[model samples]
Target: MQAVDHVTLATNNGAIGGGEVMLLRIAEALRELSVEVTVVAPATPGGVAEAAKKAGFETVQLHVKNRLSWMWQLRRWDAKHRKGVLWCNGLVPATATWGHRDRIVHLHQHPDGLHRVLSALSRVGAVATLVPSAHMLRSVPGARVMPNWTALMPRSERSPGPDAPFTVGFLGRLGPDKGVHVLAQAMRLLDEQDPGRYRLALAGEPVFVAKSKVEQVEQALAEVDALVDRVGWVRPSEFFDTIDLLVVPSVWEEPFGLVAAEAMSAQVPVVVSDAGALPEIVGSETGMVTPKGDAPALAEKIARIASGNEGVDVAVQHARWAENYSPTAGVVRVRELLDTLGA
Candidate 1:
């Protein structure tokens, strides 16, 4: 097949969330293959556009009045520049590029209600529909599964030694749905059983959420404040260096557990709740899984690991990450998918 001269990756969100991160990573991978790539996102706040530019990719910032404005702006943009594949990174972008024959609609989350309708609408006349996991494929029928992955983190020189504190860490947004509150509850349970035996470290800020939800998360964190260390908005690689284990106790059905993959890449053991694609990503051998929103079950799993009752081989987790969630593997799959589309 002949190589496509250029690919335009368009994002629905102005903010740099998991989907935007995936978009940038794919752009990097495609660029490595000598393919010309461009990123298009909203100008206001310009989070995705700015990050794309910082990463050395060409970027176009559309003057969107609001979310709805992107639909018309993207349509106008695509009408003028339809030379190569239009990769819609989410529902919004997919809607914007609707009915374009060279478009690929990629949905990073499970759809419901109106979003389900939008999901179907976004795929009309597209070359293909892509999702991050097999579980997500069930939600978006006929969509191809392309598992998410993370770049390998550099090893920390100040790695936790045997004498270091047994730290339990949480990453991602500080929201109840992401289950920061659930992790906080689990930490409280652990503290009740054996006070000062474990330390809870938290990274990330509350984002794209209501003020009430932020307050709810704060109230939950308050319950475990004495045992918590707030490490606000740091790189996952840096955050992983200070912790021995990572817990992703999300209450919602996550499309894919990117934090779990990042932790495993850092060679840290993980404990995930069986929500959405989390259990599917962690599998049975590499990490422990508990019922979603069950603080007691999560506490038990943490206690087992802390007290040496649960044998978690970090090397095995690292190997699993390398085989499945590594950037190399994800890039290869994306390359094959694009090849099939002749893009």
Candidate 2:
């Protein structure tokens, strides 16, 4: 509630995961609170780190490659800096101390052993976990669920014109698990039914190690690439302007699927797989959802939306997203945790 001196946010590289978005929001809100915020991490760039540097925050770079080394560096940083609150935005190492009782740890939906490791670290007594969805809270028990915040794009409110093509866009890492191929298969099916009824756009970068998979998909798409436009990564502000409907066809359970909320805020209807936070994030008002890994059902929903027959209320979706996940609301919850830290 009072003026806080400093906060340091450490997050994974956005080029790899979704944690950077949460970190960027926290940095912006804390900076607005007049806190001198500094970010420390590895050399990777984009997402929150890019946004933070643009907003004039100090960033320190360290070369801790794995979780073990990351923690060692974090402890050294915390010892030297001793800021108002040592905020661990994602996976990194930081030890417990009187100084960080109620220390803030923001979770961004990890999977496998990663989530287990982070959850165990969070339970080490000084950490107060901050996650973005109930599913995420359930994954990491006792973690507070806070909405992922965003500074809406200036053009996010611009309604798609009547003549604008019925476009559906998919965002996030393009992996088999993300169900990119499944979505593509659905698109191919729909294209056969009604040629040019809708245009599908696949945005976001391919996973780095997915070289072989990417080549395979590209070769497969050569058979019918015109049906889907595979646009690579773009800036954050540029993401919402190109689509009318967003689809997240994840085959696996996603922790928060912030893209669903992002689409909701942009007033774009969503169709996601009913896995993990996709169900929680994409309620009935926001969008229609299909069973995970079901391409035919996804195709059916896409056809319905493209036909403009589903009657999804865009106004209601936008209003709900703005109310629940606005930067103001997320920051308030974060600052409440900081208050418990004696900030």
Candidate 3:
């Protein structure tokens, strides 16, 4: 097969989030392999275009008024620029690039209702359809599983021992679906059992959410205000440094848990709710798993880790991350796929 000369990564979201983050990382990885890469996004404020530019990538911004407008603009762009492979990063981009022969439709979330048909339509005429987890593959039949990876952090010698108060941390969007409310409830339960034994540290603010949902999250946090440390937006390294245990209590099925992988990459112990691919990402030995949306179960698992009952080996966790969720591992898989597709 002939080599693909360049790759154009098209993102659906205007804002930078997990999917967009993956797009940036994949672009950097492909560039390192000597392939030319360009990012195509909406010409709007708080979109991927500025973020891609800030990261020193070549980018193209389309004058997209909304989703429908973006789809038309993307299709026109793909029609004009057909020499290289077009990688559609989400549903909108996938739909935009529909019927393009040298295109890859990558879906980061499971489709439901009308989205199911939209996802199917997006895959038409594409070379491949990819998802981040095996769990997600169940939703999109014949889609290849491509697990996500995080940029590795420097190994830190931080662990909660018997003497210190066990710091329980929650990082990610402060929204209802993320289960921040459940984490708050779990913290309250733990505090009732033994006051001051556990402290809750929260990072991230609500984004792309309804005002009602934001208010609901705020109200939930208010109930546990005494034990909550609202450390607004902080770097993952800094957040990991302050907490001993990381909790990813998502109610929605997270296609892939990037934060959990980052924690495991740093060799920090984690407790993840059994939602989507979280259990698969964290594994059995490296972290604890609780039932989804169950605060008492989450609290119990947190307490077990705090009391040193759970056997979590940092070395093992690091090894798992190195083997599966490392940047090198993810890059290798992507490069192989691109090579197969001649891209």
Candidate 4:
């Protein structure tokens, strides 16, 4: 509806990840600003396309078997019929449409190895390149920062009681990269020193993880199985309701910590490892931080958060800080990006 006339947003994967969540959020933001938004995604699994259509956007469902097929199909399809701004929402689509005109490349995670090679080629002939955090911008120096947002969560006063076990929540994939194994070790240490002092509300499953690593995590948690409530995948709102605090202990460099931000928005205390943007999301003033993969340090942080008073103070500052990453803030960011391109 603006100067660009139309905007076609493409997805990186058929299965939704943090990137897809951002893709959907930005699509809504685009529509709110009166931009014509059409989502391009693979037909199967169909998470991204379905969510977009449900939110009242036109969807171009590509008939494809795997990511490779989707890339080739989308690349061939766009060359013939593409118009207006083609917002390539991930490296897959960005590389697919490389050398094409008026393209915006958005990379959701830090590129490594083969992806680093592809990302270099993917940015050619694009209008702009975007990553989710300033932490990401360090590695991806040329890209602009577009922090991911959550639908502003309703604030709730939640904290562990005087006698109740302090409940810790983890809301990402149950893979080593998320530091789930590290958290399990921390829990074991917590139990060994101060028995029954903590409980973990594990709220994710192993997706896109190796079977060996998945088994490794299971074995790691086996010692404290009674203290863990393995709730599979859950929305942040639902996940936050069940715990006093949320921990994002990623071992790998994360592009953005959306779950940590959502925890802040919900007025729930959060702890993050010093990996990539996790620490950046919750600075010294807003949330807790621990050394990456250090069980003793993580356990000690959990041991320290034992009262409602500590939770109340941290949650208050966190909610205010989180305002910058809310959906409202996201709309403003998107508008600015659109306006810049429009100019």
Give the Å shift of residue 83 in candidate 2: 1.7
Clashing pairs in 2: 71-93
- Please give the range of 10 consecutive residues that has the lowest summed lDDT in model 2: 93-102
Q: Show how many residue pairs clash in every candidate, following the order shown.
A: 0, 1, 1, 0
Q: Model 3 compared with the native: what TM-score? A: 0.94
lDDT of 3 by residue, 1-343 (tens): 3677688999978788889989988888888788888999888745689988888878998887888998898899889964488889999999877888788899999999999999999999988899999999889999999888898877567766767788999998889999998998988899999988988889998877789999988898898899988888999987898898889999998899999899988888888989999989988444478889999999988888877787778778788889888989988988888788874
lDDT of 2 by residue, 31-128 (tens): 77777888876654444456666768897766656656656666676777655666776645333222444366666765357557555755564456
Pairs of residues clashing in candidate 3: 14-47
RMSD (Cα, Å) for all candidates, in order, is: 2.0, 3.6, 2.0, 2.1
Better of 1 and 2 by TM-score: 1
lDDT by residue (tens digit), candidate 4, 1-343 = 3466578999998888878888998888888898888898999979988898899999889999888899899999889877679999889999999999889999988888999989989999999999988999877888999888887677555655678888888998899989998999999998898888789999988988999999988998898899999889777787787798788889988888888888888877788999988877887554477889898988877887853433446556456555678888898998888888988
TM-score of 1: 0.94
Stretches of candidate 1 off by over 4 Å are 1-3, 157-164
If ranked by lDDT, best first, what sequence of candidates would result? Answer: 1, 3, 4, 2
